[model samples]
Target: MSFTTRPTLQGTFGMVSSTHWLASQSAMGILERGGNAFDAAVTAGFVLHVVEPHLNGPGGEVPAIVATARDPRPTVLCGQGPAPAGATIAHFRSLGLDLVPGAGPLAAAVPGAVDAWLLLLREHGTLSLAEVLEPAIGYAAAGHPLVGAVGATVTAVRSLFEQHWPTSAQLWLRGGRPPVAGERFTNPAYAHTLRRLVEAGQAAGGDREAQIEAARRAWGTGFVAEAIDAFSRRPFRDSSGRAHAGLVTGDDLAAYSATWEEPATLDWRGHTIAKTGFWGQGPVLLQSLAILDALDDGAYDTASAAGIHAQAEALTLAFADREAWYGDSADVPATALLDPAYARERAALIGDRASRELRPGSPGGAQPRLPDHVRSRVTHRVDVPDPTTGEPTVRSDGVTRGDTCHVDVVDRWGNMISATPSGGWLQSSPTIPELGFPLGSRLQMCWLQEGLPASLVPGRRPRTTLSPTLVLRDGEPVLACGTPGGDQQDQWQLPFLLRHLVGGQHLQQAIDAPAWHSLGVPSSFYPRESEPGVLLVEDRLDAAVVTALRSYGHEVRLADAWSLGRLCAVSRDPATGVLAAGANPRGMQGYACGR
Candidate 1:
């Protein structure tokens, strides 16, 4: 067998994988206690918030894909909060802004992850709301060891926190200083907030579903909403170097609810891949897969320079289409874009040399329109001063690390889920002292320009980068995987899928393989810059491979040997009732547990 950082966990019972070891172990405990996959996933999701506070919090968002044994078809759980009713292009234009501020309340959407988790627990989970939330509350109330990266992230934004948002400094700093790595940190305020929600549910009576609904209500129309609304009224400094009051009101929170939707799917090589709809960047993967499927089998050779060139070229085309065609608007030509004919036509564009232009294709003979901002600007410096200021993977120090968390769970009953939870970084906005967290800045993904499919609009979900994947064979889910790299989420996942599904590598071996992603397309985060014909690869890749890629006219850049992807995955064998899982080793945090 080929070398791997760790063995792919194998078992007949249950499996859990996530970006953090504590979350993976806690979820495994729930499964060992006889809770189903949905219950375990919910438990892990909440625990991730408390343990990985620099990455995610109660106010972030999650988009997940879930499949149950009784209902094998994949379904999407959309916890992505929409832009508040007051968020509009005209309003932003009046502020003399061409882009949404990347680090303030003005960039926040209605908080949605908490409600979505509660909804899943109410409908699919067997555990009580309090039971699923217990681990997270304990971690927050007691303490958890702070990781080194959290300290580095805090140090990056220490000055900003002290000079502008004192509330944030008050929550993240220790005795007016940055916390050291491995220190035991506690957020008693967040523990109290969760305790209050549980109490509200218990007061509603004995029915579990009613209790969960009560907690959801408490978040939306109750104390949670009240705290956020009151805090948003105060102007706070942002990436724009100006203080602005937020657009999210309690009414907007009251009007929001997490909902379920059908997944967008594609069939290739006898397996079906499912993802969130066009509103997210999920379709970029489907589109890339389609483009690759039309090419020869040699394109699947991830080790070859020719193979890498083929894949990167295919991704740039799909990303171009994503920028022009994918959005929450009714005008997104979803069907036409995924058609086989269109895929073949797009594949025909790839050649021996790299093309340095953004090429968006016309679907169904209609003209493609890109945002004028994307077309006019070549590059701009974005002030992502800290992990919270929009792009978590891209830091001001030039280090590329995932500042988000991911979890995957699969039980013996065949229930499986893959969820990517992100946003509400401790540095995103001023922390609400009462709630112990800040609002998310997801609205920065939307352009301030009007009439575009992804323009800022009230009640519209900002096109997010939190994409998760669920794969099925013969109508049963076999694999679930996801990562946290903002715009690079799907791009990084593509290579893993190709290595495992097409190249016949085992789960851990596939995840351990060197990974790369093209920076030729526009980034989904703030500044929205693009580097045409650029490909970033891990330095561990074969020297000859990198040299050949450059010879193909690609602008190749080498990153740290193990600093590209943080993929978490779980898989189940349908015929034999066996399960397996793998987690990324890049950050020394991701772990997989099973028995």
Candidate 2:
């Protein structure tokens, strides 16, 4: 009846949504083959690695929130690997560096996405490892159409590939030129690597779990780990314009394993929202929800200027706490930070006008200390803008950047999952010729400061920006959603939740709505810059609303009409056996499929 970019797909069987169409189709195919949501999701995850190589790869990391049909409680699948055993603040400072480089092996964590996916398959999935990996392997070996963004990303970093990372040049450039958009591009090396993993799994015989474990061992302790260790030892150029060897080794790879953990959850307006722990930026969403719930119902009106101001201000407060306290440490005051009293105190700080200061509240009278890089706004220069080098931004400069990828799947049996897989872009680091992928630069999120929550430490997970969300209603899993923006992942989801959960909009209508996010908190990416009072909004929002936002002492910047959010979501109705899905139309890549 009303305008929407596409219909919110409704069916009785299954639903899948992802950043790319090929991945969406592959997942739907798995579901059609009688596989459950976990199997479909694993298929999509691997296919995404092949198709969206500019955004994610086999060497990256992923974190997912999942709920099984049998057990309807949310659980976090932590695929985010930790800093290597040798990665210490002292070691970095001794190398004449104040912060990790944005793009190099020195910024790499142990590869985690592949292991994490395998773990999920081994524990929850119904299909064999080879069965789920088939689509990605086929795409890699037989060639898939290169998207325009991927081509442009390669062109932007062509000089770097040619001069410093020749191995990368060899893989990405054919006949001394970057692949053209829409042309079929093949990566035989990646295909071979995946096929070898399948062989390793098959060699273990017909036990699905054992087969998966064998493949996991092959990745961790066998040839894959050896290749990474040897290649990372070579000096490579990074964001700092210097050549440095990485700290990762075969031991780091062998020691790391994807684990399952309890999620940080908050109940609001009869719906329970779940996210990863303080180690990720996921809890910031929960904190923001707590702050918003403390306000009047009128504040939930996402289409209004006053409501937008309220949401941005609340997120600003939550992200400030993220900077001060959130990390992969036991000392995080998470319980106190999510207390109702703390939310009220934080809510009371929001005013009619935007606040330009970074204010982190004291939870339970504890002192909140922010890192020096955040407090002093220290920044470093990067010569080239790689796809995953920095936070997702709408810059006035001609620099191009890419962030992450997301997939959400829901099956007929009530199995649901939301995963954000990212890092290890083609330009993140030099590609390993044998593996056909580069190590992820996730350590760029850590600071060199000692005694801080996010300080670089051996065997500690870097505080990551990858956050996926799952929601339950009436004791059943109802919604799974996430996006790929660096710091804005949760910021964008806030308004979507408000519109759909409270305002009662259709899934597609909610996703098609104009989006905005605050840049008031320290970024979780390289250089870690923060803009105190800035808010970026899609220009499609009411012109009068933009004027009103500026009147509220907010520095508002207008982006293209559909450029703010790249979110994907899927939902299941327990009462009616109905499934629905939606995908962002911003990039013209994301797709949603269902029966």
Candidate 3:
């Protein structure tokens, strides 16, 4: 019955899995050297920045769920950066832009990934700063094999980089060309940047925590801040096809800091799911679970047409609520929206035909102020042809569903973390030559229109799609899992949990099961577009099941067998103290390591 390419690796020591093999190996190496999960994750996170530059960077954001052995209750580490103080709706509108550009300095948010990983390492880790950073520094200073996808992503926009982002060209291009895939590409400048951060930590005459705090200060208020400010002054072409100066300043970086927050949780079928609060899209899983929990029997085959239809409908309803209520603002009635009663009410709207509208109902009369783009029946189709392929760069509309990165780790001591890090991709903005990294374009998720929860507001987070999930069985932490797909992160992950928890499958079996996600809702990126009644599924599913789904009013599109998701998971059995891990094989890069 196993369709997996690799067996579920079980061990008594530790387990680490991620979107990239180098990161996973680096983490396992840390574990072998007696470092805890937090330290191992720090090492892996840094390496991920170097190896998967197109997916994430040091100038990105990572929101993580951390669970400890002593305290089984999970905690959310909010590393997602907020909008700069100068990033206001009026400021963007004054530039004659309707939506924030998806790529460029204008869409930059406060970079928070470096500080967040450092904070986790300083607080919960057993290793020194240098130990946690050594691997990534080596890979950057020397060289690491560049993956094909990274090369392709860079190639896709190589012409743009040469024309608009020369700083990016200087860093990414070898002989004015994209680095060859699988070649040993080195970033000595990036290594020096990390070295400076390490030196800052070493100079501070205090404990490990104090030193790490000093490093964070260096990143925010020191040379790094100055470099970011100077580079953003140069106008760059963005998704709007217009060049504009960015708004990020040194004060914006100084004013921000990573935080620890409470996670939203709910018990279902002997397991408790923990996710980020309303500021992110995590609660959609909780809400969807609520609706699914109300089903007559919870024992349906997940691969069946009935199961697929039910999950898609529930996700559609939940994402509708996301568009209306979920954001960084306090206007969101998160408690009421996640209520089982409300979920039951919403679930009642599911019909034989797929929902083709953005139907957000009243939650305590919250009166959802959804954006016109999200609710418009009229499609504002704008085509931007890619110079490289002579085809539309984006889809039917002007948006591309961008993605991020993830890492999951569970230690022998019962500590675990599931983190989704993204935003400041290499392709996001021009690289700051002095700092060797670019600022994140997360501000693009914010809307220019007012009165909505995700409205563009200075000093507030932009309601990111970067979400990670942790599962606890009977009040004890067991699983840390996540994936990398813009709005599809949770949708792609839900089925894995369903197959594992509902169908009693192993971790790898769950991960390797053909994945699919609904792209029916409006995308969260700039130039947001919606594809109503669309369901993108993998061809691995039974042909009959696919046909039956089409019969139920879904606009089915069959993707390659392993094209939909890049999920990774790590689980620790509370009773046996044994850990198991799995990674997606669709992309040749993902890896799982244990024992």
- Counted clashes in each candidate structure: 1, 1, 0
Model 1 local distance difference test score: 0.87
lDDT of 3 by residue, 463-554 (tens): 99988999999778899999988888889878888988888899889987877777677778767776788787888889998999999899
| Candidate number with the higher TM-score (1 or 3) | 1
lDDT of 1 by residue, 1-595 (tens): 9889999999999999999999999999999988999999999988988888778878889999999988999999999999999998898889888988777889899888998999889888998988888888999999999877777777877887888888988988778888888999898899999999999999999999999999989999999999999999999887677888999999999999999999999998899999999999999999999998899988878899999999999989998898888878447989998999999999999999998888999989878889997887466433344322223643332122225789999999999999999888877888999998898888988988777778888999999888999999999899999987887788889999999898888889989999888877788766677778778888999999999999999999887788788899999999999999999998788899998
Please report how far candidate 3 places residue 61 from its true position, in Å.
Answer: 0.3
Which of candidates 2 and 3 reaches a greater TM-score?
A: 2
Give the TM-scores of the predictions, in the order they appear. Answer: 0.97, 0.97, 0.96
Count backbone clashes in candidate 1: 1
The stretch of ten residues in a row with the least summed lDDT in candidate 2 is 391-400
Who wins the lDDT comparison?
2
lDDT of 2 by residue, 249-285 (tens): 9999999999999999999899999999999899999
Clashes of 2: 1
- Deviating ranges (above 4 Å) for candidate 1: 380-403
Give the poorly placed runs of model 2, Cα more than 4 Å off.
378-402
RMSD for each model, in Å, please?
2.3, 2.4, 2.7
Error of 3 at 6 (Å): 0.5
